[model samples]
Target chain A: MNLNATLLGELIAFVVFVLFCMKYVWPPLNGAIEARQKKIEDGLAASDEAEKELERVRKEAAVELNEAKSQAAEIIEQAKKRAALIVDEETTRGQQEREKIIAQGHSEIDSERNRVKEELRTQVATLAVVGAEKILEREINQDAHSDIVDKLVAEL
Target chain B: MAAEEVTLSSHIQHHLTNAKMCSTDAGLAFNKACADSGFWTWHVDTLAWSIGLGLLFLWIFRSAAKKSTTGVPGKFQCFIEMIVEFVGDNVRDTYHGKSALIAPLALTIFVWVFLMNLMDLIPVDFLPAFAGFVGETAFGMDSHDVYMKIVPTTDINMTAALALGVFFLMIGYSIKMKGIGGFIAELTLHPFSTKNKIGMIFLIPFNLLLETIALVAKPFSLALRLFGNLYAGELIFILIGAVGLMQLPLHFIWAAFHILVIVLQAFVFMMLTIVYLSMASSDNH
Candidate 1:
């Protein structure tokens, strides 16, 4: 081969081949690589986003749980207060009712004792008038003697 | 025309005349004569040898593929695996970021180019002469037209093709990594910039010119590096072949030296590809 021709041919061929390879082969190869890299980056981004969301949700849930717990505690406290109030009211009401019943029972017992004593006094006066009549064994007018005996009984 | 009647000096003259017809500055005349002489040509036989080499590579690798082991690999498999790993590692080291295509592309390039370069190890005249014989007997074609150069990497077309592939990849990766605006900015403002209005005025044109030159130089460098190595190796082989058959020791020595050339050329090609891709992927101007 002539050196010059060979060199020239080589140069020309080289230029053409370089152009062709750049046009056809390199793009897809590089694109495939870039695409894979992009996919990895996207995956990482998505994961990061998900993690952030998870953190936010976790915080929100925790706050909600705490709020719920606090509210529940408040409700329990309120219930306890209400129960104490009810017990206090009920105890006061029960004591007042018991006092009223006991006072009524005492008044009833005093009235019954007064009636029995009055009845005993009346029976004793009648017996005393009868005994005087039996023990004297003397004839007496019913009107005059009765008046005197009544006067004596009144005095006694 | 009678063989016995022709004097030795006259025979020499006749041969000289015939040789003269085959000589030209462009060597087109010689190429044509060689094509017409029914002995040696370039295209058809070179293509056939390329196909044959491709087939040989396929066959060898096919058998080797069957022997591939999961645990302790056989010699051939290990060798192939090592080559794959080496190419992979080179791609990983040179091209930053996640490269799905660059790695495999680099691997294929290494193996394919290496196989192509290995074709030079075959006796230069063997396949061509064999093709010549086949052309004369089986095909009944001119044997001279059957000239074949087996090593494709030695062909400027092949190397240029590889370089061009890299060039396009560089452009693509640059665009993807830098965006259109950024790419333009790199061209217009890189290596110098308008930090001050006075500096900007002076630096703008200069930077643009420099950047333009750099852009042009990129593909040229890639192309020349591959072509230079391959062409020089081809030239050495041709020179060795020209020194007559008696210089067997010298031929062997040259061939041994060419082994390094073959490997180095492939490596350079692969390395340049990675470099170009890396540059493309980089945000830095």
Candidate 2:
């Protein structure tokens, strides 16, 4: 083989092939690879963010649940306290009402007894006059009798 | 039988020679009929096959480029991608430079040289015989004079050319990175450096000689290594071809082993190119 011509030809071929490769082949393939890499990275990042957000939401839900539980406990505790207060107030009111009614009854009984006693004293005085008249059958000292009768009334 | 033996040996010899074309006193003639000698002749067969293979390599790659996608890749696309990625990875690992040219150059060298060397796998006698038959039957030319060889890498000139291209790039990158002065100084001052003036004066020439030999040997070794391997592989195939029907098993065995040789040579050529280029562009010196 003629060394010069073959060398020239091979050199030319190598340059042409290399130029074509740089222009056409390498860039597009490399671009595809880099794009795929970026896509994977972004996807991974998005998944991580989703996981973090999920964790945060779970924590918030737990906190809300705890708050709700405490609020419910507080409401129940207040309801129990209010119920006891209402019961005490009602019992005290009932006791006061019963005492007021009992006092009224005692006053009424005292007044009525006084009235009867007055009536009974009148009758007893009348009956005592009749008995004195029968025992003495004649005219007695009326001033003296009145004096007895006034003493008797004063005793009664 | 003796005449047939003579014809057979001559056939082998004719197949071995390049299909040389040159300007003669009479006119342009093919092979030994040409009057021109030395550098005037051209190996038309080597040029034709190597350039044709180079173009084929381009066509295959560019077609893949057009069809390439970021999504699911087809078989052809996948094959092309594998080759490109293989070369790119080697370049990324071995070549420390940031030049845009390195990866593509490595890819081209690997694929183009491989295609050239792959020609060795073709039966040596098949192509030339076919050409001879065509020449005799169609063109009514002398079949003996229609020389043809398909394996371009087997030709020393082609390997030398490829190596020299790398060598020139090495020089360019070296000068570009180190400056002409630094490059010259490196050529004179490496692998042996003395601070003293007297010591430097004594050492420069010896260092220059050694370093020059080393630099020249880079391309020399690169070219000769590939040429020697492929040439020996082709020679073994030619020798086996002389054995007639007995050549089948031997040819198969040698070809199977030679497949390793072919790939290894192409890989070695590309790797050396990357190393040489990286060295040229690096600053360790």
Candidate 3:
């Protein structure tokens, strides 16, 4: 075959094709590959961040649970102390009340005995005066005997 | 038997010949001065098919590039991507330069040469016969004068053209990367440089002679290697075609073997181009 215009034609065609490919084809393809790679990288980073956040949340929850447990125990201890103090206070008040009631009863009994004794003494004096009057058969000095009776009442 | 043998040899010769078009005093003439290697003579069939296939390659790749995605690729896109990746891999492995042109150049050479070489798989008489019919009907020319050789790589012109393109790139890259002085020094001082100044001076002409021959031989070998393989393969097809009915099975067998040769040759051409360009660009000469 003659090495004529065909060689030149092929050369020109090759050069043009190479230029076209360089200009139009390679960039977008490479861009797509790079973008997919970046997407995968970002996804991996996000997953790592999510995992860290989960760990932080878990630790925070555990700490909060421990604090709540200790506070509950403190509240229970305080409640028990308050209940014991209330019971002790109630016991002392009840003892005081019983003592006061007993004292009042003793005082009332003494007063009653004294009143009975006074009544008995007055009755005896009246009996004695009647017997003496019958024996003497006369009213012997009533004004002078009244003074003795008054003295006897004062002694009783 | 002698007549059959004569016809067989002529048949092979006929298939090997190109459909040449020469501008005559009267205008475009078919197969005029078919043996002549004049400036006006064009290998019509070779140019037509080669350019047609080159355009097809461009159209397919360009369209695929246009419709390409970051998401899942379609079947056509996948196929195009596979080819691009295959060629890009070779370019990456062999080409050391940072130029954006080399990879695409390698890709074009690989695919374009492959498409040209694949023409050999067509039955010997198929396209020529078709062209002959069309020529007779449309152009009012005799079918006998419409000589057409379908495979472009079988033509020395096409292969030499590709190889020469690589040769120019090799020189261009060498000059661009190493500077003119460094390139000259490399050519004149390589493969036989000595520590002794006087002795090295004596070695300059020897080195230049050998290195220049080596430089020219790169393209020469690249062209001849492809041309020889395809020409031989096409000749075999022509021989098989002359066997009439038995040619079918033989065609199948030869086609299978030629497929390997075709792909291998394309790969070799592309790899050599990349290697040559890399060597030109690298500082180690």
- Top-lDDT candidate index: 2
Q: What is the CAPRI rating of model 2's predicted complex?
A: acceptable
Task: Give the CAPRI rating of model 1.
Answer: incorrect
Write candidate 3's Cα lDDT for B208-259 as tens digits.
9999999999999999999999999988888888887998999899999999
Candidate 3 retains true contacts at a fraction of 0.63
Local lDDT at A6 for model 3:
75
Query: What DockQ, between 0 and 1, does each candidate earn?
Result: 0.02, 0.40, 0.38
* Tens-digit lDDT track of model 2 for A43-89: 89999999999999999999999999999999999999999999999
TM-score of only chain B in every candidate structure: 0.75, 0.95, 0.93
In order of appearance, the predictions have TM-scores of 0.53, 0.75, 0.75
Task: Write one digit per residue (lDDT tens) for candidate 2, span B12-116.
Answer: 677678888877777887787753566777788899999898889988988888878777779988888888888889999998768889998998889888999
Candidate 3 docking: what grade? acceptable
Q: For each model, chain A TM-score?
A: 0.52, 0.50, 0.48
**Which one is best on TM-score?**
2
Per-residue alpha-carbon lDDT of candidate 1 for residues B107-224, written as tens digits (9 for 90 to 100) = 5556567777887777665665676578678977566544456676655545555666667677778779888887777777779875787887677788889988887677677667
